[model samples]
Target: MAGHDLDRSLGLYPTMMISMGAMIGSGIFVLPALGYKKAGPAVILAYLVAAAVVLPAALSKAEMATAMPESGGTYLYIDRALGPLFGTIAGIGAWFSLVFKSSFALVGLGAYLLLFAPISQGAVVYVALALAVLVVALNVSGTKMSGQIQAVIVTLVVAGLLAYVVNAGFVADAGRYAPFTTHGGSGIITAAAFVFVSYAGVTKIASVAEEVKDPGKNLPRAMLGSMAIMTLLYIGVVGAIIGLSDPEVLKTGGPGGTASLTPMADGAGALLGGAGVLFISVIAVVALTSMANAGVLSSSRFPLAMSRDDLLPSSLQTIDARFKTPRNAVLLTGVVLLLLIAFVPVIELAKLASAFQILVFSFENMALVAFRVADVPSYEPEFKAPGYPFVQVFGFVAGIALLTQMGTVPILGAVGIILGSALVYVAYGRPRTDRTGAIGTILRARRGEEDDGIAATEPE
Candidate 1:
């Protein structure tokens, strides 16, 4: 067998689901408490600031995506616009960032469950890892299966969020925000910087361009749709949280998104009475699952793209003969995610993921400007960033500022990873492709598998 093709079952709803699930994660509920401490009441400012920064970035991504609709998202855009080397490093970094982010998403899932199922040894990690594996299995099954699952999960997630927002009451305590700059201007800015990750999910739309139905329309629609909806929900939640209690009080409560959203349940219980927390707790679980599924859908594609380009082993590039999904890549992603949840600290990973993506986003934003200026052809994406060089540049600088605000360890670590990736590129990066080359053949086989279904057709 020599060649194959991907099953194109994903449509606009699935595309929007991918983006929605990716953005409205357990973090919004989980992180608010943390921001309460960091920025006091002013954390709201951070949320708005983060939203402002991401708006431009989203628009910029839309512009580039309209021109180049591929699986790798920014990785594909940068490589096509910049060149193989810049593209390779960017793609690797972007892929790694998602893997790390997915790892935390898994951790968040298990950790949230522990609130109700706390004391079981290895239960949390095991359960989360298992969920991740389930996602991989789903993807390997077929696009239709994956699409349905994603859409359902995303729907429940949105419903749960809207429930809390609408039911959480209107009057936010002006006192909690009294000392708006209580954490100092820098503190609120820092807290908001962290919250910025909540909006990063919108980029997931750009990551699966090849499989999206009518990418030109769906891509932009999904990007803008998810962004607008998630933003409204987020603003509502933040408003509800502040109205319910003081941010300073929340800061002292717990860690994780579940910790943050639990207050909403408490607020609801006080107003609605009895089992309120339990009701929202269930919502929390659904939200966590949604995040993991969408994440798995996105992260798996990273390795698939890398393998296709000969930067990684072609085995990872393999798709199921019948499913038209990247079987090996999905499995590999599951393995990496499991390892991260098992070993790494969640907060640290969040910071790292956020910082690294900020760097990648900065590049993407810059690429938007460069491509616009260079005037490359064939990108022809459905959406464009609007405001051209100015907005993209502004977003780029803001992202860089966030990276700096993330402090020394994360910033330095991100830089180090980029360097290490470069070194890897110097070493195993450019494996030559030839008919006799095993690696090259494997990569081609993967490409072929993506072309055909499970049954490999003999070369005609």
Candidate 2:
């Protein structure tokens, strides 16, 4: 088990579905009203803005993944490029971001379940935790099994969303766009910052790069392809909601304001009546489940990769002999997610998740630039990101800008977490590890000394 590796069993379609599934969860189902509350009908622009910012990060991640083609996604790239300290932040940050996002999806799942059956809030929490356990179990079984489930869930979710969008379009009222920026440019930017979590899934596919067949081609295709599709889906969904429902009605909250809680369902109900509510509810279940499944599959890899690097307990790196999956890592991720779902407030968790992801994206952009400037011979990637440093520079800048818009609490929370991670790395991780990452190689090269094992070349 210690020597085993994840099987390269996922193909292009499953990989793409994994990305789509991770993204199209509670964000689309529940975040519309939140976005609208922040920017009214201009929330569509928020989605677009978020996508634009995420694009360069996506391409940068793809290029890095092609060069590394390993697990841990952003964690591995940042570790290799910036060294272990930043890598520690990225590893912990990526873990918590995905866990919180998955917890959000599970909580949303509980809410959707209540529509079908009356249940106490405690019961809902229990049910959500139970479902998270199930998702982890499926992931621990095998990546192929998880990928198959994701493909099915993504198909159902996309079809339901398309139906809702089309139905709402036929009955659209353009008047909702009257006060586009009710909260002003700052509001729109803030909303974009929050909803930016929706696009975080695009890079998640890279976490499983070790298990992706022909990762050089498939990784970039899956990341970019899913990002493109989800962008269109989000924009269309937001447009349909704004067109089919009154902004004031969408903004209402409470038990009576289920519309605000589930905007897509409300829009569908407005277009097709009660049956549409049931339809969208079904989509909600599938969408949230897909997200939880994909989240567990991807997030578990961070701990696995860290353990392999001796940054974490060696137990976490244990691969199940039969399934070829990191069972311990999957269990740990599931347990943490269950705790978050049961204990943390959903809104704060969502905000922090978005904030941490932005930080991770910023680091990824920096990693790409660092590696390119370092010009390590092993840094050769089959699929280079188009536009070079410009794209990465823009991504880095945009990510920081969005981070600033998240307000004080999440910003402070992220800083504290980063500081805490750095402390842990110095006290525990640094002494155990001897490998100097890409940055160390640069320093050694500057001194005309042998730079570890990888040969270095002058920047092209």
Candidate 3:
């Protein structure tokens, strides 16, 4: 592959913060109320279930990122393991999924904004758009500045959440535990699907692996470490919110139903009084806007990775000489984020983003399987995912099961994305290059060939 030409400025600390910042945003702050609406107080179980489902993909990605350590995390792995066609789908889907989730976080800023002032929904949209612009500019400048911002925001938010969890645990009403499983198994599983995107940001660090220092050691450490930290944090925060907040507000959540924006602020007000309200509101806004910033930084790499492989226009691969950032790719992502913030409703944004994320995750697991089965000599990962084929297979099955429970629109949307990506490959990407991946090894081995032809097409 062509060199990414990006600076290796992110260290272990900054890298971990980026992954944590991305994972802790909208999922914890906004979506718990919606999950509560579906699964009752059992939304705590839904968070647990969602974390369980996300674990395998996180493991798989850690393993792959260690071996590859390149830009376009999901896209690069899929392209090298499956082939360019599927790479196109993974690249586009991963990009849109991150963008959609980021936009959702920005839109959610309105709910917390309501606590500080009585702003109209239209005004909230404008605020979100403004934040999007700032995030895009931060990314265009350089990854170092972007990672620094994420580190500050994630550290402060995590501290606030830890304090809230501990304080709320002391005063939480025992009565809230009386009716935990109101909707039963089906409801909890469905709620899990809705909240699954909460953990989507855990794997985003892989996309910019090319820009990380000592990626072989730091990539696995950051991704796996963030996954473990966020899972516990998610469960604890959601449990506190359920125990402290009123059932009625969680159920209705304004006009948006399950997409209620300010569960953290509302629950904080109840648990710690007015002081708690102000504290959590500030943290929520900072946490979510930081997430959007990380999203811009990571998602922009997909276009750059694909363009380097001739899957997109070469212009996107242009790195700024001074800043060493993908300026065009960041700007492209910004335009899409602006349009999404302006046109889409909150619920649709969350559901669609979760759906696309699950699809990309399924492909990630399969790519790992392909690499192991092919057993390419160069495919050595310092950190291997435990359970081997079973873990990958289970991740794939769980992803499909959760997708089915996400309702009809998201299911259709995932299918449309696959078909659309295929069309783009056949029409625009096919004639540009002849590339093959690990699958070529498997096919050649079946014919008893001395060596596979993958080296001929793969870029250096």
Candidate 4:
């Protein structure tokens, strides 16, 4: 709570767009083919399963956001609920997870560009770097500017996707539905784990809850509405791709052979010819850019929140007087994104990012259960997640189950992250921070004392 707070400039539509925009990016255009590869036509089921798994976490976050309404999103919630040690871990983990996902989008931006021009790999890296810088600059300019850009981009991307799905519906072959479970039940589950990152956008919205126009009602509505919309869109687009294209053609591998890399364009080409390819390719660029923009908007707040708690460099807490933005944190995020694009492959970064998200989501579920069990008087949320412990428990169990299916590399990466964050906290965070966490809040409430001033207040 030092430095200038973020401006409450975003409204319902912009907030909803941020959630939807972050989720609909490069993943939808490319991952469908990889999903298909893993689960065959049954990948559509994987999308549904992943969405269902994410629903509880979404509800938990929505309720938590209304209660806290702070800048850090999951990191803030976990820190307050679980205490400083776990908070440090969540702060760092959330930052890198989002950075990894943004880097994935930037690299995908480069790949989408390749569809238009024969760009060299070095050129693609530079393009991604440049785009990252531009997005950082936009965020630094102001949150309103960023929200406006998101609205425009999200509108265009959704319109294009709807068109593609409609056209695909007309041309889709009914016979392609046969042998739906090409890889069997296990493959569908595996694919669900692999693609779960697609829903991470819903949580991203919570990161900016402090900047929303109306926290009590807007936060929950935006989170739930965006998740519902994105789920339908994902299923529709994937269904269209499955119905319109041959499994053999989608599975072909080599330079430009795998539909996994360009499912939207490829499926469009089959349905509407070259014109469709060009159309979807353009929309792909817009969609990926929107994701990067929203990612930067959401991820930079982690450092800002940590800085406020004395866990990160105080410089990151500095806000631009003119634009009222966290300039230092935004620039640092851009720098890390550029380095990640240069050093890591998109596939590896994506898998690791997805794994980290599942871990953070599991923690969110735990945080909700902790709050409910404590039953603190001051911890009232305007929008409570229905089903109480049952929904939260299912989310926690399903999140961990999905993590198990992610294979060895991402699993190891998550473990390494946890260990690294623990070391950082013990060495630096423990000495400087003195905030009372959720458990302490409950104890105080039990004694008829005021909760830490973190709970949401009604607008004047």
- Clashing residue pairs, backbone N/CA/C < 3 A, model 4: none
- lDDT per residue as tens, model 3, 1-460: 6555777888887887777876888999989888887788888888888887887888788788768765467898888888899999999999999899888888787667766877644466777788888888889888565456657777889999999999899877879876888889988998899899988877767655556787667877887677778888888998888788777776666444444578876667755665898998888888877677767877898899999898999999999998898999999999999999888877778888999999999999999999898888888876688888998999999999999998888998899999999998999899996767888788888889876555832434
For candidate 2, what is the lDDT? 0.80
Q: Please report, in order, the local distance difference test score of every candidate based on alpha carbons.
A: 0.67, 0.80, 0.82, 0.79
lDDT of 4 by residue, 300-363 (tens): 9899998887778799999989989999999899888888888876566777888888888888
List candidate 1 segments past 4 Å from native.
1-18, 118-153, 170-174, 207-226, 245-249, 255-268, 320-325, 377-382, 431-460
lDDT for position 220 in model 3: 70
Could you tell me which 10 consecutive residues in candidate 4 have the lowest summed lDDT? 451-460
Q: What lDDT tens digits, residue by residue, belong to model 2 across residues 196-231?
A: 888887776765666788876787778878888898
Error of 2 at 221 (Å): 5.8
Error of 2 at 295 (Å): 0.8
Q: Report clashes for each candidate as comma-separated counts.
A: 21, 0, 3, 0
lDDT of 1 by residue, 102-213 (tens): 7766666665566575554245667667777776677667545455676786787678767666766654455555766676878866776677778888876665655677
Cα-based TM-score, every candidate: 0.80, 0.88, 0.90, 0.86
Backbone clashes counted, model 3 = 3
How many Å off is the CA of 319 in candidate 3?
3.2
Positional deviation of 352 in candidate 2, in angstroms? 1.1
